[model samples]
Target: MSLLFYSCNSQKKAQKKEAETHKVIQKKYADLLNVSTTEIKNVRLYAFIEEWTGTPYKYGGLSKSGIDCSGFCNVLYNQVYQKELPRTTKDIAKQLDKVKQSRLEEGDLVLFNIEGKKNAHVGVYLQNNMFVHASTSKGVIISSLENPYYKKAYNKGGKV
Candidate 1:
């Protein structure tokens, strides 16, 4: 029984160590991405996508507890691409160069603004016209760009 108890303790320690290692790795990659090093280690942006999936949404928030639309984009870009972007959807809307939606890559950011309306929301692309966002009520979730709501409100997409 003592042996089993020791093993359990070891396992917990190993899990804790692994979690620490992940933070180190994430920080290292974020640093590289921030510098725009010619070679990016993780082209697997999807790997990063799944990290923040399903976080609850909140106004004036930029963390897992809750997050707004532009807050989602800001966090993704800063963490994945290591670029600090403007936090407000409106600021992000005008900062990036426009790209055709058909050509959007995984790291590209999407903006949704109804016709004749100012940009009010943002999200990160996943693929197949899918993006991830923290909605006002839906929280952090993957969304279909082709969804009727997003389709009608589509503004444009941009690469960081």
Candidate 2:
């Protein structure tokens, strides 16, 4: 009877600790993204994006040192969604369900036509119209879909 009580107590403590840790993570992301912590529905995904915030961009690269837009998307999907994706923007786009930009949700892929090529660039959409991508000149950064440059280059959004 004593052991049962102890087991229940220990489980309760563990759950409490987990809740507290989740709160901390929520607060951290809320501050970083400038939104309410309650708006953060997926803490692990938020943390994953935060982890690569400042990585540099490199064509055909796939690590912290450098990563292209599609490479970053591939890594994100593989790690956060446990799904493997095609390595190139065109290929990735082919695998995803086409979605209108107005309907984009978190984790959706935003396509761009920077060089007039179909799906020339890709970024992972986050909440609030923001998306993270490996910019050729600025490396990895978050930009708004409303940005004039992106607006002009916008192609579509995709859901895997």
Candidate 3:
């Protein structure tokens, strides 16, 4: 009886800790995305973003120390959605069905044409016009679609 009681107590404690961690993660990402905590679903996605946030950007790089836009998206899609993505931005764009910016949903791809190049950049859509990417200057960061730079460079949203 004592063993069973202890097991139940330990299980409860573990569950409580997990719930607390989920709340913390939701709060953190909600603040980043400028939304309420309740809107921040997909705890795994946010947790993954939090873990990789601030990683340095490197051309053709694919590790935590350095990652590029497509690489970041690749890692994100693979880990979060269990989906495999093409290695390059252009290739990834090729494989996706184009989605309008206003129609984008969570886990959709946001393609960009920076500097007048087609499909030159990519990011993973979160919500409320916010997407996460490894920017050339900012490394891993969350950015808004409404930003002037992205606005002009915006190509289209994409989905698998």
| Cα TM-score per model | 0.69, 0.82, 0.92
The TM-score, computed over Cα atoms with residue i paired to residue i, of candidate 2 is 0.82
- Model 1 per-residue lDDT tens digits across residues 1-160: 9999999999999999976666565565445334332233354454565566778888898887887888888877877778999978888877888899999876788988755676878888765677778887788787788889999888899865
lDDT of 2 by residue, 34-135 (tens): 789899888778778778988999999999999999999999989999998899998977887998888888889999988768888999998778888999
Worst 10 residues of 3 by lDDT: 92-101
lDDT of each prediction vs. the true structure? 0.75, 0.88, 0.93
Residue 145, candidate 3: Cα error in Å is: 0.7
Clashes of each: 1, 0, 0
Cα lDDT, model 2, residue 150: 97
User: RMSD, model 3, all Cα superposed?
Assistant: 1.6
Give the residue spans of candidate 3 off by over 4 A. 1-8
Best by lDDT: 3
For candidate 2, the clash count comes to: 0
Candidate 3 residue-wise lDDT, 1-160, digit = tens: 9999999999999999989999999998888888999999899999899899999999999999999999999999999999999999889888989888898998999999988799999999999899999999989999999999999999989798
Candidate 1 worst ten-residue window by lDDT: 32-41
Q: For candidate 2, give the lDDT.
A: 0.88
Q: Please list the Cα RMSD from the true structure of every candidate, rounded to 1 decimal place.
A: 8.7, 3.3, 1.6
Please list the residue runs of candidate 2 whose C-alpha ends up more than 4 Å from where it truly belongs after superposition.
Answer: 1-25, 31-34
* Candidate with the larger lDDT of 2 and 3: 3
